[model samples]
Structures are given as C-alpha cells and as structure tokens.
Target: MYSLHLINKNIGKFYENIPFSGLTSLRFMIVDENVQDRESLKNVLEFLGYSVVSVAGYTEASKHIRAGENYEFIITAIRSDSCMDFEKFLLSVKDFLEDSSVVIASERAEESCFQSFENDEKIAGAIHKPYKMEELERIIKSVRQ
Candidate 1:
C-alpha cells in the first residue's frame, strides 16, 4: 500500500479553475517508480474529479499511452535508476496530442531540467520531488490552462 502522508497534505486542494468545469472528460495518468508516489498521485487526481490510471515506470507508461487513446494529463517522474531517458519517454507520448499536458517530477528539479525540454513546448511543466498534493494540483491547473 502507498503512504498517505503526502497525499493527506493535499486533501481538499483540488484545482478550482479546471478548463472544463465538471471536467468529466479529464483523464490522467501518473507514472512513477515508487508505488507510494503513484498511489498518492492517483488518489489526489481522482479526488479532483479526473479519471486516472497509474503505472510504475517508463515501460508501462509508454504502453498505456500507446494503447490508442488520449489522456488529458500525464504526471511522470524522472527515473535516473531506470536507464531510460526522460526525453525519450516524453517523445513516446507525442502521438497523443501536440498540446498534451505533462507534469514531470524529479528528485532534484534544477533549472537545467527546464532547459532540457525548453525546445519542446509540449512539456507543460515540472514538479520537484517530495511534492505535496496541493503543489500537484496547482501545477496541473497551470499546465491545463
């Protein structure tokens, strides 16, 4: 089971300005290495009225997106341990939409991280590691806008 500490912190902090009110069509995917992180993100997104799916790493993340469906949001983590390039993982998601919203999470989210995808406008934004649920909500709302 995933830890609830981080997720509990985000309770009630849903994105208020969802581009589409009611957002019945907002589907999200949370891709991260840690089971706890994935579960936490899934819970938070679901609470905010989004239909969510989750995967543990890049491999599964790619599979889910490649299943011939479109998801409104993708929240992923940079996995230095997985031998996969974050850029490549993101590229795999490009077939979905040119304006897809992606929120990348990293343990050390330095400005250099932003530099990596600066050329690719599809990458909506990033989240630093050890994030609270509220922070995730804010990022999602900002990126969706």
Candidate 2:
C-alpha cells in the first residue's frame, strides 16, 4: 500500500491512517506522550495537507503556547502524572487559545473527562487516540459549523 511509496528518510514513523490523498487549509497541534503515535499522526495529517505540530507532552505544548503560537486545532492527551491539573492548565492557557478548538485525545474513553470545559466554548470535542486522520478532519469540519 502507501507504506511503500511513503517510505522515506524524512518520514520515519509508520503511518497507519493516511487515506492516500487530500488537501486542506487547516493547522493542528498534537500532544501525546508516545513518540510513535505522535509522529505517525503528525505524518498522516501532514500527508493530508494540514499543518501539524506534534509534541511529546504538555510541557512542550506550553512552551509553544507561551511563546504566542496559535493554531486552529489543538489535539491533546491529558494525564494526571504529566499534567497535574487539567483544569488549571487549560485556565492558564485559555487566553492564548481563545479562538482555537481544543480536542481532548486519549486511548481511553474520555467523554466525561472534559465535562468541566463544557461551559467554555473553546472545547470542540474529544477524539480517542489511534484515531484515523479522517476522524480529525471531521472534527475540524464540525468546528466550522
């Protein structure tokens, strides 16, 4: 399949969700602890013609946000060990991402985890990890509507 054609020095990770072709004027920031997932997802999104920035954890994401970097979408996985307080972290960074849609990403079922942020319009929704690049595209499309 595409794995053969896409095998190059620049894209080292195995992309499991790329659907061959697409084009979009969207930007995304993906935060995940697993290097494989983060890079693969970033690669897939990039392949589909989206601007993607992948980071290992919240700490790295904070550096970009603190530096005044903004994106149309922010897909992140929150962990108690890495980010002690999800609410506090979101609150602290809310100003910088007011126009951005925050999508919580996790391998676990995390529908209930984002309840607190329901009042805040910034939260677009939640997308489970290992998600297909198409799923993320859907979320972004919905954000426009």
Candidate 1 wrong stretches, greater than 4 Å: 1-21, 80-83
Off by over 4 Å in 2: 1-23, 80-83
Which candidate tops lDDT? 2
Question: Candidate 1 on 49-113: residue-level lDDT in tens?
Answer: 67998888877777777776567777788673275678777776687654457777877857797
RMSD of each: 5.9, 4.5
Q: Which 10-residue window in model 1 sums to the lowest lDDT?
A: 1-10
> Per-residue alpha-carbon lDDT of model 2 for 10-31, expressed as tens digits?
4343434445433466778988
Cα TM-score per model: 0.75, 0.78
In candidate 1, position 34 carries an lDDT of 76
